[model samples]
Target: MPVLVFIDQSEGQVKKASLEALTYGAKLAEQLGTHAEGVLLGKVTEDPSLLGKYGVKKIHHVDHDELTHLDSQVYTKVIAEVATSMGAKLIIFSNNADGKTIAPRLSVKLKAALVTGAIALPETGDGFMVRKNVFSGKAFANISLKTDIKIIALNPNAYKIVSGEGTAEVVSFAAQIESPKVKVTQTDKITGSVPLSEAERVVSAGRGLKGPENWGMIEELAEELNAALACSRPVADTNWRPHHEHVGQTGLAIAPNLYIAIGISGAIQHLAGVNRSKVIVVINKDAEAPFFKAADYGIVGDAFEIVPKLTAAIKNKKANG
Candidate 1:
């Protein structure tokens, strides 16, 4: 049986997380001595065959208008049917908002063992065991899946995307599309900003900046770095920043390549969401701040003084080059 990967898309474009999932799935399939295939729902503007570079041999496309919008129940039902028909023993999904919503439901429908937040490939020496993050990125847990059919949700940015020269054969899958229960009446899209979830670099701040008026420096730093802007939960609750910019245990989780924190206290709740960042740089005047302990590099100085200098240095380097 071939490994089947769920390719998640937004606005007819494949998500970065899904590319990571495809690479992971393709590697896993190679390990299992089987080929990797992808399943895409909805109409996409990009060529499905281009995903072959990520290692999938084929793509099963369900080109339906209803699938443009995510309906967890409908997605689960259709995917379960496809898996059953294709006899896919292993299924992979990107552990994002859509994957989180659909994977569990598909697991229940297919009666398969489901593992979420998988950070690494499975160890198949003895049995199928997958390593996943537990306790909000604080710890690792190895889960053993005994079922014949297994489902794994790869954490976003957990695996590197490997692409090579190839073209996948795209095939049309005739799935029974159903109407979505949830209706999206309006979409408030934030334009001209890097999406926090998919951002490679991020510059974030907290109440230490004092108020919304002080946000100009943070924005300037982020703009210079070409990174996303984020804030702590309190800043959002106080209405200093929009709630969507808030990142913590109760808010959106992110794992960027570079995370720069300014004036944030680094509470445990806040760390849970961003601790997976590869490199963390914390800037604060308070040397006793807890965030410094978790930071890869700590600057014990005022962000107001440090940020401008750092931004200027970056500008100078870019200008000279």
Candidate 2:
């Protein structure tokens, strides 16, 4: 019984979430007393051998240009084939956009039991049961799998990406890869001050800033702290910021070590997205803002005054260093 992990990549590069999956699979393999391997669908820019540090004994790579772009239908068929050929009893996926589309399809095709948005490693004592977040991270659910094969799509940032002392050998498996039905016409990228999903600290804003012009204060503070800059849905919807910067139930959900919100009245929808942040700081003039309830710390004041003072304090601390 071996564990096979799907390494999600974009533009010839593996995603941060894939590393989390790799780490998770490696630990699972240890717990089960089995070997862990990763399958790279497309040609990744990074050296596949270096991934051995993550505990994948071999990397099954199908380096086709068509594989670079995601085609849910075609990719699912190929991956299911890989799992079957490799005799993978357990398949792991990252609960990112790619996993959201591929995991369900592969589950149906392989007739395997699957759990998405998994928050913790599976409990494999009696039956395979995994704990996951429900109700937008407000609740938890333990799903038990009852199939010969089990599939899990792990939620990003839920598990730590841990590595050990040794590197494993990388073996290349040859498979008949196929072209995807969907062609890559273009891709609009989101550039962040800090990688949002992987950032330890996040600074966010909303319509309370009034307009894009006032975003400088937020940026200045984030930059000073080397934190990711994020926004609420209204900011993204109104074009004050890009959609990628949106963090909420309808947008990108994050669980950073520290999340700072300034000038935004937190709506329940928005709260659902970022409620997982280890520490939440809400800065709103209205002390009664709903976000304050979820926040670990609250300050009732104007952001314009508070942000500059905070930025100056951080800058001063850095200068002294």
Candidate 3:
């Protein structure tokens, strides 16, 4: 049976997480001695055949206006239909907002085993076991699935994306799509900043930055490193920064490649959200700050004095290169 990957898109553009899911699904298909195929519901600006670069052998596209905005019920039905038509035993999704909503519903409908927040490829030798994060990123757990149809939602940033020189054959899929009950009357997009959920590098601050007026250095450093700007819960609560930029358990959870925290005292709630980052750098004046323990690299200095130096150093390196 072939492996089916859901290609999540927004505004006619594919999300990075979806690309990661495609890479992961393609590798899984290789292991299972089968081929990986992608299914996209909405109209996309980019050619679906280009997904072959990530190892997808074929792409089934259903270009419909109704699929543009995500309607969980409608999307689930279409995906179920595609999976049935393609004889896909394994379905893969990125454990993002849409995935979390759609995977479980589809699992119930298909009578499949569902696994969310998968951190690694499954161990087929051990009855198809998958490792996942538990305890709010504080620990790990291995789950075993014993069902005919299996669905896995991969955690963002948990898998490496591998690309090759190839092009996928694009095939048109005719799904019985239905009218969406949920109508998006209007949309408000966050402008002038990177989407925190997809950012690879992030620079976040807290109360120690003192106030919103002191955010210039933090913004400059983030710009220098081409990192997304984020903040702790307190910063957002105090209106120092927009709530969308907040990163904590009570806010937006992020798992970036590099996370730099300046002036934030690492509370458990804050750590819960960002601890999954590949590398964490903490800058705090207090020597005994809790964030130092979790940081891959820690700098004991004032943000005001250290930020400018760090920005200048990065600029110099770029100039020299």
Candidate 4:
């Protein structure tokens, strides 16, 4: 049986997490002596065949208008059907919001052992043991799945996206469509801002900036770095930034390639969200700020003085280039 990857899309575009899932699934399939295939259900603008570069050999597309929006129940049903039809022994998903919802539901429907937040490839030498983060990114756990059909929801940014040659053969799969139980009355998009969850680099601030009026320097830094803007929970609660931009245990969790935190004293709750970042740079005047413990790089300085200089330096370098 082939390993099936769930391709998540937003606004007709495939999400970065989905690409990671595809690469992870394809590699897993190669280890298991099976082909890697992708299954997508939506009105996607990008051709699924283009995903072949990620190592997916085939793609099963169910282009239904109803699937354009997320309805967890509806998506789970369709994916379960696809898995059954294709005889997929393993299903892969990114441990994002959609995957968190649908993977459990699909596991219940298919009676498969499900593992979420997988950080590494399964250890097939002994059994199907997958490594994952636990205790809110504080520790690692190796879980064993002893079911015929297995489901893995990989953590975002946990695995590298390995792309190579070839074009995936796109196959059409007609599935029984169902009406969505939930209704999306309105959609409000944050214009011109990169989604924090999908950002490669991020610049975040906290209460130390004083107020929203002083956010220009932070924004400029983010723009210079081509990074997403984020804020600590207190900043969002105080209306210094949008709640969506908040990164903490109670807010949006991000694992960007580079996480630059300005003025924020990283509390344990806040670190729970961004500690997964590949490289963390913390800038705060207080030398004893707790965030420094987790930061790969730390600068003891005032944000008001340090941020502008950093932004200008980056701009000058780009201009020279």
Q: Which regions in candidate 4 have their CA more than 4 angstroms from the true location?
A: none
Model 4 global lDDT (CA atoms, 0 to 1) = 0.92
Q: Distance (Å) between predicted and true CA of 116, model 3?
A: 0.8
lDDT of 3 by residue, 1-321 (tens): 999999999889998999999999999999999999999989999888998999999999999999999999999999999999989999999999889989999999999999999999999975899999987888999999999999999998888888889999999989888999989788798877778898889999999999999999999999988899999999999898999999988898888999999999999999999999999999999989999999999999988999999999999999998
Off by over 4 Å in 2: 319-321
lDDT of 2 by residue, 105-172 (tens): 99999999999999888999998899998999999999999999999999988888987666656666
- How much does each candidate deviate from the true structure in C-alpha RMSD? 1.1, 1.7, 1.0, 1.3
Q: Per-model C-alpha lDDT, please?
A: 0.93, 0.89, 0.93, 0.92
Task: Estimate the TM-score for candidate 3.
Answer: 0.98
The lDDT of model 1 is 0.93
Candidate 3 pairs with clashing backbones: none
lDDT of 1 by residue, 1-321 (tens): 999999999889899999999999999999999999999999899899999999999999999999988999888888887888889999999999999999999888888999999999999999999999999889999999999999999998889999999999999999888888976677676999988988999999998999999999899999999999999999999999999998889988889999999999999999999999999999999999999999999899988899999999999999997
How do the candidates rank by TM-score, highest first? Answer: 3, 1, 4, 2
Candidate with better lDDT, 3 vs 4: 3
